[model samples]
Target: MSVERDILAKNDREANANRREFSRLGIFALNLVSSPGSGKTTLLVETIGRLGGELPITVIEGDQQTSNDAERIRATGAKAVQVNTGKGCHLDAHMVGHALERLAPAADSVVMIENVGNLVCPSAFDLGEAHKVVVLSVTEGEDKPLKYPDMFAAADLMILNKCDLLPHLAFDAALVEANARRVNPAIEILRLSATTGEGMDAWLAWIRGGAVEARRRRAAAAPRAQGCACAEAAAKA
Candidate 1:
């Protein structure tokens, strides 16, 4: 117990540092987590397609092996860095920090970190994201949130993916949302089909809002040195 606590404590410290760096760079970082085959990669691809040109987007793909995900992200014309975790089940703050160094995302850019597919392990690790978005596919059933309460609880947003297949599947989307809210009442939910582009507008808008807020916070945090642009702007406001 003591060893586990110590390890998590160290991770928390590193996560705080990563958070500070993200704030300084005005990056809206998102950690996307889910079980394997939950369509996280597909969702990311669709998201990038919709917003890649509008926003300077970068991705850090985490997987046990292979850089396939990163390659796919790069094909979208966005910069991506792959962090092969090998035997590790999740990407910790230290690993994400290293990936950030390699990514070098532009200021005010949005960085999406696609975590290794695992509902259990990834929820326990903080990768210094502005929010943790969990993708749950309808094919996985409506009881997933109850089965993996920790993951749902840790997420700021729950994305019900593959909704276009709901007609073929018996999955109840409402039940899934209820279960997610049971674990995390404050969690915002979005239903979307990455394949058909349905419901993507809301998702893109949410990301835009977060990115705007990140830049706003960064500007507000800038030092008020005499004649500094930020300070001058603030004084004018």
Candidate 2:
């Protein structure tokens, strides 16, 4: 128990530092987490297609092996860095920080980190993101939220992906949402099908809103940053 706590404490410290750097660079980072077949990559591809040119967006793909996800992201004309975690089940703050260094995402841009597909380990690790967006497909059991309460609780937004499959599946969308709310009442949920482009407008709108807010924050901090630089120069002189 002590060892686990210590490891998490260290990870949190690094995550805080990463957050500071991200804020300084005006990057709106989001950690996307879910089970292996939750369609996270497809959602990202669609998202990039819709907002890539309008807003500078970059991606950091984490997987046990292969750069397939990163390749898909790149195909949409977005800069992406693939982090092969090997045997690791999650992407920690340190890994994301290094990926950020390599990607050097544009200022006031959105940095989406697609974490290794797992509903468990990723919940315990913070990747210095503005929010953790968890994707849950309708094909998965409706009781997943109850089973993986920690993941739902940690997520800021719950994306119900593959909604197009709802017609063929016996999954109960309402029950799933209720379960998710039971675990995380404050979590905002969005239903969308990346393949069919259904409910995509809302998702795109949310992304746009986040990006706008990030830019606003950066603009608000610019004057203070400039003043600090001027003061430092005067002191040196």
Candidate 3:
């Protein structure tokens, strides 16, 4: 058991190192995870439309088959790479590491990784993202967090999409937020209707916030990881 735990811890540590390297390369990356039809692609397209030219943005779209999502992202004026995971259920850090070579975003670019639409598997894998944004829709029911706690717990940001049609559905928005909070106390929630553009600005602001924060953290940790033990400790601290 101790050996297994050590292996798992080593994987997570390596994933964290990859994330630091991505930051050091001047890339602001985000992993977008969600179930099918949860509007992850729509939100990403909208994000690209708003963020394009201002920042060089790229996307990696993962699916079991077809490059459909990557096609949509390409239409939004962002470079996109399609990764058909075959039998794999998640996009691990190693996968992202390979995809980054194909993506090749500019020095000050943002990379959005749209993971395969699985609430369970994707959350279990670390894709070396600065933040994991879980896209949950009102149509998916409010008990989703209870059904798939790992995804909610792993997410740094939660996007509740499709709020425009709330009156026609039986979905409980308050219950969803409550349950998500129970699983992830520190999650930043953004309720938005991607179709109607209702809450998009807030979500965009949160994305900007994550990018800025990631860059600042990377800059602050650069010089300390040189030689001394105290310096290494200070770099991480």
Candidate 4:
């Protein structure tokens, strides 16, 4: 118990530092979490294609072994750095901080972090992101949220991906939303299919809204130069 607590304590400190850096740079970061085969990478590729022209976006891809997802992200011409967490099941805050340094995303840009395909460990690790967006495919069971309550409870938004396949599956969308809400009453939900582009506008809007607010907050929090020339200029006028 002591060891576990210490581990999380260290992670929390690092997460705080990462958060400060994100704020300073005006970066809106999203930690995407889900089980394997949840179509996170596909969604990202589609999203980048749609918004890359309008928004400056970078990616930090997390996986246990391969750089496959990172390659896909790079194909879209967006900057991406792959973090292969060999034996680790999740990307810790320290790892993400270093990745941020390597990526060096432009100020007032969006940083998409595709976390290791796991629902359990990633929920407990804070990667200094603005929000944790959990992706759940309709192929998965409707009770997934109930089973993985921790992930749902930790996420700020739950994206129901692969919605275009709803007619072919036995999945109950309402039940899944109910389960997710049971775990997190305040969790916002969006349904979309990365493959078909269905319901993607809402997801894109959500990202845009967050980026705007993050940039606004960063500007508001920025320190003004001491004895600034702007005040002096105003006084002269």
Per-residue lDDT over 144-236 for candidate 4, one digit per residue giving the tens place of the 0 to 100 score: 999999999999999999999999998999999999999999999999999999999999999999999989988877646334767888899
Best by TM-score: 2
Model 3 Cα lDDT, one tens digit per residue, 132-218: 999999988899999999999999989999999899998899999999999999988989988889989887777777667766766
User: Candidate 2 — what's its lDDT?
Assistant: 0.94
Model 2, residue 23: distance off in Å is 0.7
| Candidate 4 residue 215 C-alpha distance from true site, Å | 0.8
Model 1, runs deviating above 4 Å: 1-6, 223-237
Candidate 3 has an lDDT of 0.85
Best by lDDT: 4
Instruction: Note the Cα lDDT for every prediction shown.
Output: 0.93, 0.94, 0.85, 0.94
Cα RMSD, each candidate: 4.1, 2.1, 4.9, 3.5
Task: Give stretches of model 2 more than 4 Å off.
Answer: 1-6, 234-237
Candidates in descending lDDT order? 4, 2, 1, 3
Give the candidate order by descending TM-score. Answer: 2, 4, 1, 3
Q: Candidates' TM-scores?
A: 0.92, 0.95, 0.87, 0.93
Model 1: which ten-residue window has the lowest total lDDT? 1-10
Query: Lowest-scoring 10 consecutive residues by lDDT in candidate 2?
Result: 1-10
Clashing pairs in 1: none
lDDT of 1 at 53: 84
**Between candidates 1 and 3, the lDDT winner:** 1
